[model samples]
Target: MMDMRDIWIVIIALGIGTFAIRFSFLGLMTGRRFPDWTMRLLRYVPVAVMPGLVAPLVVWPAATDGDFDPARIGAALVALLIGAGTRNTLGAIFGGLATLYLLLWLL
Candidate 1:
């Protein structure tokens, strides 16, 4: 187990890192214009980031005996299908949560 001081250090590092990222963007964009390619790439950041962030959670879920779980895998599939069909964020969230809850309850 980590000590309180270690936890504090981790929290402080996270805070500093967050601040640095925000500040870097604000500072860089103060008076400078981003190039077309840079702007185009920035537009896809969320598109790229959302999947990257979500993929792992779905692909490798926890198990009772320390193994990968398939319950989340099914929920993720349902969520992906619903999102693709409806193209709505609320629908995707609720669909995913509902599927996860139902699966967890049943299994």
Candidate 2:
């Protein structure tokens, strides 16, 4: 068994490490400007991240025990269509959530 003091020490160390890692970027990049190439690359950050984050949930939802659910897939499709058609993130989110809840209630 581990000692309580040792567990608390580890927790404090992890907290300090996380804070330092996050603060290091802010401290170093404050008032700094990046090159055009770097700025352009950074602009694609959201484009790269959103799909990676959302794709798995659409394909296999946790609520459905990692099985494919038509309702979840349908909601993703509706969100995609709304986003592509209207080019609105908020609208897409609202449409997706509404579709998910409606389908869940129905199915």
TM-score of each: 0.72, 0.74
Residue 29, candidate 2: C-alpha displacement in angstroms: 1.2
Please list the residue runs of candidate 2 whose C-alpha ends up more than 4 Å from where it truly belongs after superposition: 1-19
Q: Candidate 1 lDDT, tens digit per residue, 51-90?
A: 7877877766444454566678778888889888997767
Query: Model 2 scores what on Cα lDDT?
Result: 0.89
Q: Model 1 misses residue 34 by how many Å?
A: 3.7
lDDT of all predictions, in order shown? 0.81, 0.89
Top candidate when judged by TM-score against the true structure? 2
Give per-residue CA lDDT, model 2, range 35-101, as digits (tens).
8899999888776787788898988778889998999999999989998899887898899999999
Residue 107 of model 1, lDDT score: 81
